[model samples]
Target: MLPAIIASSRIVFADDALDIVQGDRIQAEIDALRMEIDDLRDERDEASLDATRRTEIRRLITDVVADAEMRTNRIDRPWNVIASADGDFTLEADVIMQYDWVLNSTSSEPTRYGFSLDTLWLSLGGTMFGPKWSYGVCAAVGSDGTFIPEYAYVQHQFEDGLFVQAGILSEYFSIEQAINPNEQLGTSLSFVAGQFDAGQPEGILVGRQFDQWRFWSTLSNGWGQSYIDPLENQRTGVMTRVELKPFGDWNTLYMFNPYPGLVDRGLLFGFGGSFDWGDYAAGTGRSISGDATRATADVSWQQDGVGLMAAAYYQDVPVSQTDGGRRWAAVAQGAFFPVSTWDVYARGEWGAVENGSRSDFAMATIGTSWIPAGDSRLKVVFELVRSWGSTADWSVDGDIGILSTDGDQTVFRTQLQFAF
Candidate 1:
């Protein structure tokens, strides 16, 4: 009936010819359906023109199989998809939110609101079998709300400049509290730069690089600080660091180039100081804790876009009986960046407990930060604090009494952050 509908048409069409059906109008509609099947074989009328040419060739193959199943269901549906391959391994995630506003100028009710979940963070870093061993794991959501583990690490490279690291990481202390946690301007921890409450211990660290000098060392356990405890005792501690650049170009000052469009002048100087003497006992011994000493000293500088840092700390407590007491603390900080997302900061601290009757402390803070779009993952900060001791108790003015009746207490804070 038109060559039996093109020999029982099974539709295997892909040699590309019918550019949308105009090959001389499909050969003049198959030559007018073979002259109407030879005029119905000369008058029997070939069963009504073979049922109207097999219903117009089954409606043109059901409209070309419904437009190829609507473009294969819009490319196998999956909201905004992206997958990778070619040396594999790629994963990422980050979600963080924070808000804090506290003002209590002697509480005639100034303002107070604090919300945190500051980081729901989960990141499983990559690069393996190729970049001389690189690995990472950063987890979050803790402060007792569970899911701890922050930064499980591995980094190894050996030859000349040497390198090594093993398990649970991050302890090189205060490079803006260990490398910018969203550009921290403040939201706690200035009782003299000392809160990262540990966590991530089970260690080994070694580093070396010569020419513009660099060095490193570490040993751990010393009572796991955070992440809700990780075997709290069996005291151990050690740390050492040294760095110097003095302009001999370590890849233009340790590689982080930017300037074509501005922002990134070079200069870096360094030193990191640490010490921890140990043997501690306090599970409720009433009064008797052995040898505990802490030490710190730091200096930093950055050029062009401007950045400067400073640090100091000292702690020694050896009170086993009435007349044997000692305690000490100190802190200092500074920051500036007239643009490149803006920033300004200041800090000061002091502490004491010699001959204890609890009344030695001092604090000061000043801050500002605005990231607008320079995207340190979005940030905004404002801080002003002035605390005066009685051995300052925790936070929120040590939960009221304004540090023993307003001898000195002033606070104003603002924070808004989002990281993802």
Candidate 2:
């Protein structure tokens, strides 16, 4: 009996020890589960922090890129916005001021001197919808107390090299003047320019532009300087030009061709001519009237640092109570530049006006212009003028008249101009 009792106690003790070992294993499993939960929480928090930092970095980079682009691409005011799809628009503005001094050798009129706002131009242009359609507008404040709409037009490309432009556009005769506004040699229009002005009717113009050529014609009111109807009569005219570039063998010469130069340079030769007829009546009674016709030709050559140009014009004026009148004029200009920023230029012009009832008068002008820092768009010019003929009453002396009768006299002038 004693042996059996001892065996039972041993069995009981062994069973209890086994139960204790199983309980300890359950506790260890609970501890391990808690540690796993804590690790998962730490991982989720770390991931959230990393994602937030990445998002902040992306936002910072995006803002920086947009700001830089704005600075590089914006222009002047009024027409600030162009086309905006994929950033396909542009804006621009130009301002100019000039100071001039005139010394009249025949008149003593206080030696007229003054400063003037030569031009203030604002322009906007861009493409829209696709690359095929483009538009532009240019407005200006003129020195002669006038506001001019310089250009407003839309152009469409139908195919490879053909395009059409229609609007109140520039006449072909005036295109060169518009492009090289800063390089005009004098304060007023040249003799040939005046004649062409009568021939160049300003209104609606149609133009075609190709790889190396452009042709344009216009139907406009023929009154020359007077834009008002009461002061001038209307007329009709047409103008055209053709330009060509040859020498496919000379690539080096092509780079600095004078015809196209820094702006419209190429092997450039162009022919421009115009014809016009108009009628003008004097006084309240239509009793006295005049009819006029004008024609002109322009030829130019340019290469590298040298440029040469000549223009001639003729006008026929027939009026009542006065004999038929005629006028002829010619202008020649040459320029040389050893460097890009400096240029020396000279121009000569001669003009004559005659009528059977009135004595013939002639005018001549010689001028030189200098551009010291050519890139600044600053220029200085000096002009000496002499007038002679039967009716030479056009001479001035320091803003005062010296000789009242027909004779010869000299005039001196200096002009300084800046553009931006």
Candidate 3:
């Protein structure tokens, strides 16, 4: 009986000790779970604060960038500017019209009384990232309703003063070519330029400016072609020109739309030449491959309400046989500005074709123009022209002619021009 009582007491004591141990284990697990929950809450709070700081920093950075751009870069707009902005960009246009009345006609074109659109041009250009880079484009509407692209080019000017240009650009090849109709002593370019000088070429131009001189050279495809084309319009050409300002910037020259205003002063002397090599198509069932060469020289001076200019040209065209035969042309011109708005001028031209026949033209011209500003001009020009020498004449309109039926021509031409 004593052994049974002792065993029962020991069993009860073991059960109570096991219960206490289980209770302590359960409390420890609860405390560990509570600590994990507290750590999670702390991490969530820190993540929210970090996110807020990042968003504020982004807003501040955006504001700063916007302010900097506003201070440095801006677009310009102006009234009366077509194609480009007048403030930072450039806009250009030229429109011309003329009336010709033929008193007598010897050859095919009998309908003489008419009105003609001489030129219709619109242009846009601008410099970007400062004056070191530039781009421009010009378009023309021909009388025959053809749309032509003119000056579509880009240019980069280096720090050392060298400039590179590519595409279609217009810079006169000679003094005669440099003179626009309104600025010319005559109503049109000399016959030498008309017969041989290609109007404009598409290619690359390299130029440099010195203190008292400027020089440029071009490698390009001739009229009616593009440099990107290597097959059909196989004509490749090169032209180079040099100008000397003996009187300093007083004689600074602009290659296009040159205006040697007597109001300002200086002397400008220039020389230039060009040659074209290609497979040429003259007439039906014929093709000639050879070189066509040309040379021109000119000088101009202006001071104290007086201006004078003279120019000459020479050219050689290969015969259809690609061997012996050749053609040539020459011209001389001068102009005097007597008053602020009045001018007098004269030009003489001579040309020969493959047959060795020579012809010539002489003209006297008078002009009066109004200058509203530096880039805007209006002019009225009158010219009396006489044809002489050989009956085979080259006219300014790119026509080889016999000065009318009797091999003599007397013409009175009047023209009006506006440019801005």
Candidate 1: regions farther than 4 A off: 1-88, 91-124, 130-132, 135-154, 157-163, 166-169, 172-186, 189-359, 362-386, 390-407, 412-414
Which candidate leads the pack in lDDT?
3
Residue-by-residue lDDT tens digits, candidate 2, 1-420: 999999999999999999999999999999999999999999999999999999999999999887766655453434435434255554444555556666555433334344445446656666755677777676677667666776677777676656666655555653233234455545434434544453223455556656555666666554342243535554455555454444221222222212223533334454555555554443545423444555556655556666666667666755342322576667776666666644555666665666544354555666655666544367676777665543331212112112333555566767777766
C-alpha lDDT of all candidate models, in order: 0.56, 0.54, 0.60
Query: Candidate 1 residues 255-337, lDDT tens each?
Result: 12121223344444555554445433447453233554555655554455444455555445455533224555566665566
Q: In angstroms, how far off is 207's CA in candidate 1?
A: 13
2 or 3, which is superior by lDDT?
3
**Candidate 3 local lDDT, residue 75:** 39
In what order do the candidates fall by lDDT, top score first?
A: 3, 1, 2
| Per-residue lDDT value at 237 in model 3 | 81
Instruction: Give the C-alpha lDDT of model 3.
Output: 0.60
Candidate 3 error regions (>4 Å): 1-111, 179-182, 222-229, 233-235, 248-262, 278-288, 321-328, 352-355, 358-376, 390-395, 398-406
Q: Residue 305 lDDT in model 1?
A: 45
RMSD in angstroms, all models? 24.5, 8.1, 9.4
